[model samples]
Target: MHIAEGFLPPAHAVAWGVASAPFVVHGVRSLTREVREHPESTLLLGASGAFTFVLSALKLPSVTGSCSHPTGTGLGAILFRPPIMAVLGTITLLFQALLLAHGGLTTLGANVFSMAIVGPWAGYAVYKLLRRSNVPLMVTVFFAAFVADLSTYCVTSVQLALAFPDPGSGFLGALGKFGSIFAVTQIPLAVSEGLLTVLVMRLLVQSSKGELTRLGVLVAQKQARTGTETEAVGR
Candidate 1:
C-alpha cells in the first residue's frame, strides 16, 4: 500500500525519512561495491528493480488515503539482502511517485518504510528460515513472495491506523478496519505474486543460472538434491 503525498503529518513523514536514511546510505555503498566488483550483477539489479516497479504500479482501490498493490521485493531481498533491497525499494517508490503518480513524494518515507524496509527484510528472513528447514524449493520461493506482499500491506495498515486512529475505538479498531481492506484485495494478489515469482525464479535458474547461482537462490536445495541422489545410489 502506498501512502499518498501529504497523507502523513509532516513530523511523521520526516521521522520515517530519518529512519530510512541510514539503511539507504549503506545500501548505496554496498550496491556500488557489488556492481564494481561483478559487472554482471547490474543486470540482476535492474531486473529486480523492474519487477518491483511493475508489480507495485498496478494500484488497487485504497483504504483510507493509500493504495494497495503486491510488492515484488521478495526475490530481491533474498538475492541482495535487506540493505540493498531498501535502496532499490526507495528508488522504485521515488520513480513511481514521480513517473507513475502511483505514490507521492511527501509520503515517500512512509511508503519506503512499509514496502521496502519491512517487507523485504521479513520476506528474506522467512526464505532463509524455510531453506534451513529443508523446505522444497518452490514452496520456499512461494512463501517468500507471498509473505513479502502481505507484509507490505500489513505495515501500511499499521501506519494508517497509527496516524488516523478511530475516535471511538482507538488504534485497534482503526487497525482492523485498515487491515481488512488489505486482506480482501491483497490475499489473492499475494498468492498470484507467489506463483509468478516461482515461475520467474525457475526460469532464471534455467536462463540466468550463473547469476542465480552466484546469488545463492537455491543453494540449499541443490545440495539437498545431490544428497538425495547419493542416498538412492547407495540403496
Candidate 2:
C-alpha cells in the first residue's frame, strides 16, 4: 500500500502527518491500556503484526500496473479493536520499511494513515454494524475486508491528490482512477484475506478459549482459577 515516494507533494505529506497525529496518539494510548489490562493481548498483537508484515508483502497483480497486497488491518480490527490495531500496524509498517524497503521513510506516515487508520476503523465499523450471529462470521469478514481495502485505496488517492493538486490531476480524477483500480483487484484479495482471517480466528477460538477472555471478550474459567489461586495464596 506504499504510495511510492514523490507521488505525493510535500504539502500533502505535511497535511497527512497533521491529520494522522491525533489518531496515532489515540492508537498508542489504546494499545497501552490493552497491554496493561490484558498482557496476553500483546502476544496476539505481536503475532498478528508479524503475520501482517509478512502477508502484506506478497505481491498480487493490480489493474494500475502496480502490485497490491492485503493490508490485514481489518482482521486485526475484528480480532482486537481499531485503535490498538492501528498501533500494531504502525509497528509492522515500520519493520517492513526498515527490513524490506517495501515502503519509503518519507511516505511511511501517509501509508500508515491510509492502511492502518482508515482501513481498520472503517472495517471495524462495518463489521460491527453488519455482524450479528445471524450473519456468518466468514461473510462478515469478507465484506469488512472488502470495504477496508477499498477504503485504504480511497484514502491513498486523496493523499495523492493533496500532493498533486494540478488542475488536470484533481482529487476527483485520482479518486476515479483508484475506484476503478480497486474494483478490479480488491474483491479477490478481500475474499482471500477474509477466509484466512476467519480460519485463524476459528483456530484461535478453539485452541485458546482463554484468549478472548484475556481480551475481555468473555470471562473464562482461567480467571476464576487465578482468583482461587490468589485467595489460597492470601490465606
Candidate 3:
C-alpha cells in the first residue's frame, strides 16, 4: 500500500511527513544496536531483505484496482528482532522506489512508517507475546504475521483518511472504509507470510548453526568465555 505523491493534498502529505520523521530516526538508531548485537548475521539479514523486497513487489489487488502486497518485515522481526528488520525495511523501500518505481520518493517516509516501523514492531510484539507460553511455533507465527499485516493496512488507512479527510467523514467513516479496503487481502497474505517465515527460520536453523548462534537464536552449551557466555553476560 505505497501511497503516491499527490494522492493526498499538500497539507496532508506534510502532516504525514512530520508524523513519520520521528519513526525513521528511531528506526536508524535501533538498527545500529541490532547490528552490534548480531554482527555475524549481516549476510542472513541481507538475504532475507532481498526476499522481502521481492515479496513486497508482487502486487495483488485488495479493492478492485487498488493493490497491495505483503510487507515481509514481520517475518524478519520474528526471526531476528524488530530493530534489524527496520534496516531491512528501509532498504526494501528505497530499492523499490529507485529500482522499480513501485513507490514514490516524496512519500518514502510515509511508506517507511506504514510498512517498516509499524509492521515489524507489531508482528514482533505479537510473536513474543504468543510465544510466552507453550503455543505451537507455527501457530504463533501465523497469528503474529496476521496481526502485523492487519496493523500495516490499518495504519495505511488511518494515514490516508488523515490525508484525504472527506468533508463528511468522521472516525467511524474512516474505520469503515479502511476495514473494507484491507480485510480481504490481508487474511490470505498473512497466512502466506507466516508459513514463509517459519520455513525460512527452519532453513537457517538447518544450514548454518554458527550464524543462528551469532544472531542469538540458538543457545549452545555454555563455555565459561565462549560466544554464548559473552552474549549472556552482555545481556
lDDT (Cα, tens digit) per residue for candidate 3, span 1-235 = 7777557667666676677677667767766766787676667767778768767876755544566677777777776677667668878888877887766677777777778778888998888787767587667777777777778877877777766555686766776686677756676676677777677777777898777666555656464437576874664
Model 1, span 1-235: residue lDDT tens: 8888888888888988888788889889988988998898999899988888788776655434445578899978877787888989999998889987866888898899988899898888899899889998789989999998899989889988998999999999999998887655687788878987898788888898667655666453556667544543542
lDDT of model number 2: 0.72
What is the lDDT of every predicted structure here? 0.83, 0.72, 0.72
Question: Poorest 10 consecutive residues of model 2 by lDDT?
Answer: 213-222
Work out the TM-score per prediction.
0.88, 0.82, 0.82
- TM-score of structure candidate 2: 0.82
Q: Give candidate 1's whole-model lDDT.
A: 0.83
Q: Residue 143 CA error for candidate 2 (Å)?
A: 2.2
What residue pairs are clashing in model 3? none
Q: Give the TM-score of candidate 1.
A: 0.88
Residue pairs with clashing backbones, model 2: 9-163
Candidate 2 stretches with Cα past 4 Å from truth are 62-66, 213-235
Model 3 scores what on Cα lDDT? Answer: 0.72
